[model samples]
Each structure stands twice: as structure tokens, then as C-alpha cells.
Target: MKNDLERAFEEARRRDAIELEWLGASIQGRPTFAEAELLDRRGIPSCHVWKIPRNEAPVHLTAIDALRRWQAGACAMCSASPRRLLVDHCHRTGLVRGLLCTSCNTAEGLQSAPSFVAYRERPPAVILGVEEMYGSPWGEEIAPSDASPEERTQRNAAHVDAAEGLFAGITDRFRPECADG
Candidate 1:
């Protein structure tokens, strides 16, 4: 009996509730640098720390936790179990690629780097069904491998821009000087 507008409002409210829950869980589950170091020193693998109680977590968070566990807490590229791993995502499509160490993440930003080429050839998100869980931004028909050179260049440029934007948004709270204290 609900009108279209009423159904739309209900859907929007449902989505907002999900987003708020996700944000709260993310903030609560994330550890500070010092906390991560302490966990590391205690001979504990911090990989599972990204998760909250499964019943309370959103589907996306649970999916990420599953993916992280599948990767065995190591950098997807170098297999280094760094205290903190960055979530690598496609800048053009906003789909998560995989977890990476700082060095690999930085290297991947370069268009000519082997990491970038590898990513373009086989995006982890697409391969591992992460994109399916997250929902694809675009259809697979326009995948990077099938794109023209100009399209690839534009995508690479977008990636660099997105990475720079992310780095620029980091506040002093996350800087090494502040983290050390």
C-alpha cells in the first residue's frame, strides 16, 4: 500500500542506519599504532583485530575480515606481516583491491611500476570476489585489461590523484611523531 516515495524514504533510512553502524564498528575495531605494536610484541597476530563480534558486524566488515584472514595477515604483494596494513582500492571504481604494506602501496601508485601493471592485469578485488561482495562500480566489460592505452593512462592518473588525496588527508594524529608518543 506504500507509495513509491514512501518506499524510497524507507530504503534511504535503512541505508543510513547501515552506514552509521558500519562507521561505528570501524572506529571501534581499529587499533592505534601503539596498540598494534603492543599486540605485535605480545606474539599475537593482529590480523583478526579488524573484526568485531560477527553477529554485530556489517556484512562488508565481515567480508573484509574474511579477506584479511585469507591473506594470512601478510602484505598481498611482499608477504610482510606489517603491524598495519593499508586497504588498497581502485581509485577509478572505488572497489577495494587488497591489503598492502606501505611500500607496496606506494609503489602501486606509480603508473610504470610492475605492481601497477600487475594490478591492472589482475585486480585482486575482481579475482577474489571482493568486488562482487562490495558491488561492482562498473561492469566487467570495461575492465582495465580490455581498456585502450588512453583509458589505462587516465585510470592510472586517477589512481595517483586518489592516493595523493588520501595521503594529504592524513592528520597529525596518525603521523609518526604523534604515533610514537
Candidate 2:
């Protein structure tokens, strides 16, 4: 297990360095620039992200931490990764909450902008915060919610599009095999 510990330490260092790099990049164009300055201003320690619920801080890296959270049955959104996760937040409010990966968080951002015509349209469920059987970060069952007819219709349309794409890809992948049949 010593080797495993060594690997974990190395990975932690790498993640820390990379996170710092990203932090630097994010603040580079701002008035005050410098990675160390950003981290100091944000009060980020070496181990975890800081100050925001969805800002990817408080990421669990060690197997022990992951195992403990899993044992306790954590929310799936948080369990999807091990190294670290970038949580998202409400940019308008700037509240230190909205834990999600970079994508989900960004999707929220893209979806949240009211001034942007494209993002102004939001799904009813997201606007309502209605809980439903949506996939969690961890591989656990989530009971979504009852949707309105319109929402159901939209969901069906999306499913159909996705299934069609999947089938097309599969058919393309197996075209040579199909020639024999």
C-alpha cells in the first residue's frame, strides 16, 4: 500500500499544480494577476478548492475520503470523479453554491443568462427545481418527477434524437459485419 500512497501523493501534487495553473489562467486578464495572489485572495489551501459550494473546492482525492463518502451514500453529482471536480455557481448571484463538474456548471451558466436570448429559454423543471429520477453523479437511483405534457413531449423528442444518433453510430461501426448478413 506504500506504492499506492506514493501514487496518490503524486496525483494530488499534479492536481494541485494544475488547479493552480487554471486559477492563474482565469485571473490572468483581470486587473490584479498572479496565481499565488488569486489563491491567497480566495483563501484556497493546498488540499481543497475554497469559498464556493460549486466551485470544485472540497474535492475528495484519497480513496479513503471517496470510500467514506460512498459508504455514507453521497449525492451522485459529487461522486462522478475522484481527482477533483469543478463545481458551478450562479454567476449573477455569485453565491458560493452549485456543485457540479465543469460542464454541468457551465451548462447552468449558459442556461442561466437572462440577457442572452439563447439562454433566456430554460426548461420548466430546471426553473422549478423539481426533483425527479435524474442520474446522480454516483451510480445511484434518482427518482425524477412527474412532468407536464409539454415537458414529456420534449423529453420524448430528445430521447428519440439521442437513440437515433446512437443507432447510426452503431450501424456505422458494424457496417462490414452487416455486409455478410
Measured over all alpha carbons after superposition, the RMSD of each candidate to the real structure, in angstroms, is 12.1, 19.5
The local lDDT score (0 to 100) that residue 19 gets in candidate 1 is 50
In candidate 2, what are the lDDT values of residues 1-181, reduced to their tens digit?
A: 4798899999889877754543343322222224423443453211122211112322433322322222122111222233444433222222123234454345445543322222123221122222224332444322223555566456545655666796886777677866654
Per model, state how many residue pairs clash.
Answer: 0, 14
**What are the per-residue Cα lDDT tens digits for candidate 1 across 1-181?**
9999999999878866775654444324445555655654553323334433233334544446645644546665555678998877665544567777897688777746444565555554444444522322343322255566678567667656765787775765677876773
TM-score for each model:
0.40, 0.23
Least accurate 10 contiguous residues by lDDT in model 1 = 132-141
Which runs of model 2 end up more than 4 angstroms from their true locations?
A: 25-181
Using lDDT as the measure, which candidate wins?
1
User: In model 2, how large is the Cα lDDT of residue 7?
Assistant: 95
Question: Where is the poorest 10-residue window by lDDT in model 2?
Answer: 45-54
Question: Once all C-alphas are superposed, what RMSD does model 1 give against the true structure?
Answer: 12.1
Q: What is each predicted model's overall lDDT from 0 to 1?
A: 0.56, 0.36
